[model samples]
Target chain A: MALLELKSVSRHFGGVRAVDGLDLVIEPGQIFGLIGPNGSGKSTTVNLITGLFPLTSGSIVFQNEDLEKLPTHLRLQTGIARTFQNIRLFGQLTAWQNLWVAQNSPADWAKRGFFSRWLGGQSGVREEISQLLEFSGLAHRQDELAANLAFGEQRRLELARALATRPKLILLDEPAAGMNTEEIGQLRERILKIRAQGTTVLLVEHVMELVMGVTDRIAVLNFGQKIAEGTPVEVQADAAVRKAYLGGGE
Target chain B: MDFYFGLAQIIGVHTLLGLSAYIVLLTGQVSMAQAGFFAVGAYAAGMLTVLAGWAILPALAASSLLGAAVACAVGFPALRVKGLMLVIATLAFGEAVRLFFFNFDYQVARGGVKLGPLGGEGFRQIRYFPENGWTTMQVMLFIWIFVVLVMAILWWLDRSRYGAVLRAVGEDELAAQSVGINLTAVKVSAMTIGGAIAGLGGGIYAHYTTHIEHASFGILLATFALAYPILGGLGSVFGTVVAAIFVQGFLVEGLRFLGDWRNLLFGALIVLAMNLRPKGFLDAPTLRWIRRVFGGKRGAA
Candidate 1:
């Protein structure tokens, strides 16, 4: 069974079809890359899967469960976590607190009673939060407000925040948009490490270098439609994919 | 000494009101319906004690429950709207509550003297304190007891995961929702908690003042309930207490000699305070400095 499946999803904004009749299937434990030019419905696809907006027409199935009725938070509770393309950390909250707020996994609930889950102090999940901070290289900056962190640190914190949900599938929306080469390398290693842990990754990126170096299977989108689907080398060789990226003359 | 105790009682009750607003404000909601909850609590507790002949403590508990119930009901529809619309929704709710009490009449014969809320005439002679022979000092101390308990609970909540979640929701609803924080539950819970606090405060205010009119729970009181937390800073619960003291004890009481001119200074001073401390009186840096001075290492956030 697929980890996530989008069946002919179409979202229209008053006749402007942002995402028109798109179908996608992501297998469990697969690092799926979704690459597209600006306004190619890459973000819209992510939004639809995450239930940020209602689908104009289609069904999104996650872990074999239809997600038509679940709200965004409930969908996340079912183990679909995502990081925004633009960082959206709680500015007033500390970096540690950011991840602390995202610990909504079923396991987390089972670990503590209702009273402890909320009003109880952070002592129970201290180790888990610290580990996430360590993973993001933000342990030293944990006490600082997320807004005060550097841009790179903020991005890492946002990823860490998503991971805090203990998701089976994580979506990274242009996580490398403003990153330097070194940072992108680090992010690639992070994505591989995330996949190694048996959690599937959906990487949406404009940075072809990171996409080519990381994704196991790539899907190209143009004008809200899939233009190509293949491995990196196969996608690179595709004439249509080149035409979508380059120009009509190709 | 009596005047100081009276002032202390007012400050304590206002602090509760402020803390009530503080919890709701933490979720980035600017609710004006707090005064409505407070009014409900005041009337409920007063009627329970004065007419139903119940003990003050039990009456207060019932009032708090009623307040929470009303707030929960309002929260569902009010939270559906955002920003200024929420404010308007809450303001309308507050006015509705006020008007309900304004036209409310529940007087009953008590030893040949009518004793209950009469429409427009107001609920007078809530003599639980005076009749029980509780001194001004005693009443002030009693009010402070609940004030401290509320502040402590909120302080503990600030250190908990729920506190972080509330702040996260306040920071960004999109990110909060994506991270699986139920916006409705968190918001409604905050609203409910706020209602309980405001209700408790109102109960205390009824006993301390020994009277309450619908006019008292108007928009101005609602604004003050919000202002205390806003002016104090959302950094911690203590900010609300500090702001309540500054506003009630300082501005409302201390400047009384200025008479008619005092109201103008009150407005100007609050504006000035806001300008000086945009994040509230106890913003992050100031809180950090205070913590350092007090030999504490942990930051508020």
Candidate 2:
């Protein structure tokens, strides 16, 4: 069974059909890539999946359960988490605190009492957060406020924060937007590592280097519709994708 | 000595009020409805003690519960609006609470003398402390006990995961929500806790002053409730306490010899303070410095 299924999902902004008749099936453990040019409804599709904006038509199902009425936060509780296109870290909170607040996984919610989860001392949970900080190469910077971190470090922290939720499917909207080659390479390894842990990734990106290197399957979108869907090699060979990306005769 | 005790009582109550706003402000909502919750607590506790003949402690507890209930109820609808609209919504709710007290009239004959809230005249003779034979110093200490309790709780909360969650929401609502923080639950819970604190403070204020009227819980009180937290900085709960002392003690009481002219300076001083310290009077950096100088535990959250 597919981990996520989008059937004819459409989100229209009045006269503009931001995402029209989009259908996608993401199998579990696959690193899926959603590539599109600017204004091609890539972010809108992500927003729809995360319930930031409701769909104008059709349905989205996760683990075979309909997600029509689920709220944004509840969607995360159901094991779907995402990062922002532009960095939106809690500027006032420390890097450690940022991931601390995102520990909304089912296990975290069920095991701890209400008081212990929220109001009690952080002693019990410090070990877990420390491990996450170490994974993101931020052990030394754990106490530093997120705003003071360098740009690349902030991006890594955001990814680690999303992972803290222990999501089954992570939607990363341009995680490598403003990055040097070294940073992108690091991010690619991180994406592969996330997939190795059995969590699926939906990478919506403009940077072809990371997507082609990491994604197991690729889908190209143009004008709010899927133009091509296949393996990386197959997608690169598609004529429709070529026209969408490089614009030519027919 | 009595004058100092009375001033101490005022500072204590104002600290509770400021801390209430501090929690709500952490969630990034600028609520002007705190005075409404305070007024509800004041009236509820006064009626319980004066008319129902309840003990002061139980009456104050009831007052806190009522305040939290009203705030939780109002939070659902009022919190739907954001930014300036939310401000207007809360400001209007505060005024509505004041008007309710203004037109509210409930009196009962006790020992052949009418007692209770009498509309615009306000609820007078809330003399629980005096009737119980508690001295001014005792009452001051009593108020400070609650103040210290609230401060300790908030201080602990600031160190907890919930505190980080509140700050997360304030920093970015969208990101916070996307990260699985329920915008409604987090926001409403903050408001409810804030209401309880304000309500407890108001109950204490009614007893200390021996009087409370609709005019007391007006826009000015609400503004002051918000101002203390902002001036204190959102760095920690201590900021709110210090801000309350600075405003209620130094600005309002310390300059009393300046007569009516002090009011002008009060406004100027607050503005100047804000200009000099845009983040707050006790921002994170300043707080860190204080801890360093005082030889406190370095890097303690």
Candidate 3:
């Protein structure tokens, strides 16, 4: 069975069919790329799958469980997490505090009573957070306020926060959007490292060059419908994807 | 010299009143009838001590119990409402409670049936605990201790996951709901906790004041309570208490200099606190910059 599947999903916003009759399957551990020109409904598809918006009409099955009905957070708890196109970090909190909130820490829950979790302090949660920060290379700035971080660092921090949730699958929406080429190179390495740890990744990116380098397979969309799905090399040679991009170039 | 010390002793109520107002302010809700509930708890303790001839220590303990009980009872409905609607509801409840004593006829006297404090003449003799030197002073000490303890507990709670979730839910309901924080529980818990603290303060206050009158807890008291919190800043635990003491103490103690202008001074103070620093005392981040210019230490948020 596919790790995640969307069956006949469609969404319309006041007579504009943003996504229509889409059927897609992401197999276990595949580094799939969802690519299209501007306003091709890539983000909407991610939102729909993450339960950010209720489907117009569809069924999304994640790990054999129906995910269309679950809320975004419930989906997160069920080992599915996605980063936003626009960063949504809790600005007032510190970097580690933001990361800590993303992870479901079992520290002194009143429902679970006091003495049981009182002794389970910062050291335990700190080690896990430290490791994730280390992987994302954000450990140095862990104590800083999230809002104060540089734009590139903020994107890296978002990656760390998503990893903190320990999701089986991660949906990254333009992790390299505002980064310099060197920063993008670092990000590509980190994404590869993240994939090596057995987390399935589905990336939605506008950077054609970025998608071509790492994506094992690419699905190209135009006007909310998938027009091409093949290996990166195969999709690069496709006439329709080239026509779609040429019609709406960066 | 004796008058000054006595005045200072009386001023101790300012500290407790400030703490009570601060607690309600922290969670963005106020029970204008706190003074009413405060009286209920206080009267419960006073009646137990004077009428039942119970030990003062046990009576004080009973007072807190009565306060919490009354809070839970009143909180049942008041906790569900919000903003000015809640303020009005608590105000009416306080008035109803205060009016019940003088307006309603009571049958007292170990089985003798009489109605009203007017008809029941002998009750006045038993109204107050006999003036024991320094007893009021000792109650004042307990209030200080309780305030410190409450502040400490609240500080820890502010750093906890429960507190974080409450904040999360408060800021963005959609994000918080997505994170699975219960909005209803956060709202009610804040009200109950704030109400409980106010009630406890009221119980202690009863012993210090040594009198219970219908006019004692009016809408003015509620307005003053509301004003104390706003002047300090509503969200910060530290700011609210400071603002509370600043407003109440200045109006009460500073007024000796200008007898007729005390209330005018109070209104002016609220206006100043709100206008100069709308976030209240320490709430404005701008204050930190001001402090730095004036050679003061930086404060935490």
- Cα lDDT tens digits for candidate 2, A1-250: 9999999999999899999999999999999999988999999999999998899999999998999999999999999999989999999888989998999988898989889898876688888888888888999999899999999999999999999999999999999999999989888988988999989999999999988999999989999999999999999999999998998887
**Candidates, ranked, TM-score:** 1, 2, 3
| Candidate number with greatest DockQ | 1
What DockQ does predicted model 2 obtain?
A: 0.84
- For each candidate, the DockQ is 0.85, 0.84, 0.17
Clashing pairs for model 1 are none
* iRMSD values, candidates in order: 1.1, 1.0, 3.9
Given candidate 2, what's the lDDT at residue B56?
Answer: 89
Error of 2 at B19 (Å): 1.1
Candidate with better DockQ, 2 vs 3: 2
lDDT of 2 by residue, B52-125 (tens): 98998999999999989999999999999998999999999999999999999999999998999999999999
Instruction: Name every residue pair that clashes in candidate 2.
Output: none
Off by over 4 Å in 3: A11-21, A37-39, A105-124, A220-227, A238-240, A248-250, B1-134, B164-192, B202-236, B275-279, B283-301
For candidate 1, the iRMS in Å is 1.1
* TM-score (C-alpha) between model 2 and the true structure: 0.98
Q: What TM-score would candidate 1 get against the native? A: 0.98
| Residues A1-250, model 1: lDDT tens digits | 7889999999998978888888899999999999988999999999999999999998999988999999999999899999999889998888988988899988889988899888878676789999999999999998898899999999999999999999999999999989999999999999999999888999999999999999989999988888899899999999999888887873
Q: In CAPRI terms, where does candidate 3 land?
A: incorrect
